[model samples]
Target: MTATERPDVRPANPHFSSGPCAKRPGWTVKNLENALVGRSHRSKPGKARLVEAIEKTRSVLGVPADYRIGIVPASDTGAVEMALWSMLGARGVDMLAWESFGEGWVTDVVKQLKLKDARILKAPYGELPNLADVNFDNDVVFTWNGTTSGVRVPNGNWIADDRKGLTICDATSAAFAQDLAWPKLDVVTFSWQKVLGGEAAHGVLILSPRAVERLESYTPAWPMPKIFRMTKGGKLNEGIFKGETINTPSMICVEDYLDALNWADSIGGLKSLIGRADANTAVIAEWVGRTPWADFLAKELDTRSNTSVCLKIVDERVTALSEEDQVAFAKKIADLLDKEGVANDIAGYRDAPAGLRIWAGATVETTDMRALMPWLDWAFAEAIASLKAAA
Candidate 1:
């Protein structure tokens, strides 16, 4: 059935999934029509559009003057792997793990790369790996925002200015919603499908001068794949940052990203984008304050993520349910919201316990989130009543 035809049980509000977030206010069929389709990506027009996107992104995001931005192979994961495989091994590596994504990167380093000297700094989900414990003498990998647990580092003040090692940051959900202190970050990776609400498949890699030096000077002992190789014979590939993708890209996705970027610009750039996210999250924060049964999953207020707000049912009654029953109950509430179309994909990550995850990304309006809060309350109440009857 069409969106307009959905039953009254569904709240009249848009969805707030973590990735593939809600499209911008004016995103429409006509916008898609303007996208480049069935066009040669290597052609002048295609290259020009690509360059425009890169420049627009830099302008909107306020990237540093010397940094290079490249459109890489896979989404954020690919860009991050490329950086890790290319620039690491010259020095001892420090892998920080606080959530699933960070843990995945650690697995890649120790298990996949088999790096023997890597240092691991870990914390339970919803908390940060010790920032002060990090050794500035080694290359460090970290996620600026923990999407699954809804925790984030408050700022970059902890990073040493004179540190010798590169700081690789996975800022997938953090890029547009939060201010990036670029001076402290060396190699940063993100996807189009995140805060911009564009299509996925390609990742954006931003490299600092130090990162470029590493790429040109030191190569990983392991064999480099063509896609991961950013330098040839000790020289950086300048064209890659100028819209020359390593492989063929979907121009449709490119144009869609451009659409999102344009929308971002129209809304007054990063400030406005962050404002929307902050406002959307505030709605949830208010709800959390009033709802005794639910509380934020993040441990501290300063660490709470504005983009992906994770919540857990705090009622002791929920803990009393069998593990399977608790999962079933949470899934029932998620399915109820999904069927109603008030929200979709609010279920927490598989590694996380039975909980709810709401995307309060910039593209999602505060009004939409406000409307969605009641629906969540209703769905939870109804699901709990059903579970009680069954019990």
Candidate 2:
């Protein structure tokens, strides 16, 4: 096939960005008609809506009975910052980095807080640090999924069951689509706009009993911002966990999340969500297996993320070019797909190595994924022909 030849079919829905990802199949603005737009989030009805979101999340994800789940301000970043700022000083900390977001957290711990006892465990993109070497005696901070690199920890088995310190996980991209080991994680944070495909700017913060205990006992050396404050007068602010937000929230976003959660429940909850994502990833994996030009960025099968499936161009014609040309080549393919309206926002993250990043979360239909495969092939062939013509 040449640049002039195109695929016969295009993805039914082309909203495949890794964040603010594709909405649940059949999602519509009309579904959000009941959003409490004019009402205060703290109002009786509004808080009930918020509580419903929380309880439904717990019920769907199987979060423990003892864990406290709260709707926090900002996205996953805010939830992570709250945990890092409020919980790290009490013990030595180990920070892990394999991708952009993980590197950002490393900067927060080492540069922002300037924790003297911080130990950094890092790996190049597409790889994971040695999980067995992690020091459980020190509070550990890591991303459950490396969104930029499409890598993830295989499971929570590496985390010690009886660790002395907390495990704070930034799980924005992993929630719903992946199984999170709740007991192994003391503090886990995710945003509404990730796998569930809800609106952005709101984060969910889940805390185990151990995490709450740390909040009650340990205070950070730096001053806590109003939004990061989870405790008051040395006791956990129980209301936050019960739908009383620390700051005003957008009721519309809340309503959107509620709709997504209800959709998740209706579709057989977490098991179905995971199966859908797995099926979507399998579509890409099979395509990559047969395609000569592409390969997964993740080095290992177990570590590859089902949500953010990153791929690198391996065609010698492209890889033989200068680094800048390689990036341009990858961008050309992404642009071609976008222009064809078969895919959108499929380019690799800016800081990540130049490649393709597809969101194969539960919300994205596998049929759409199967349809998008040929478009990718067409786009790559078009890019290669353009490259030859330019030469």
Candidate with maximal TM-score: 2
Model 2 worst lDDT run, 10 consecutive residues: 1-10
Candidate 1 wrong stretches, greater than 4 Å: 1-13
For model 2, how big is the CA root-mean-square deviation? 1.0
User: Which segments of model 2 are wrong by more than 4 Å?
Assistant: 1-4
lDDT of candidate 2 over 55-155, digit per residue (tens): 99999999999999999999999999999999999999999999999999999888999999999999999999999889999999999999999999999
Question: Please, what are the lDDT tens digits per residue for candidate 1 over residues 32-106?
Answer: 786677788788998998899889889999999899998988999999999989988999989999989999999
Give the number of colliding residue pairs in candidate 1: 0
Candidate lDDT values, in order? 0.88, 0.93
Clashing pairs in 2: none
What overall lDDT, based on C-alpha atoms, would model 2 receive against the true structure?
Answer: 0.93
- Candidate 1 Cα lDDT to native: 0.88
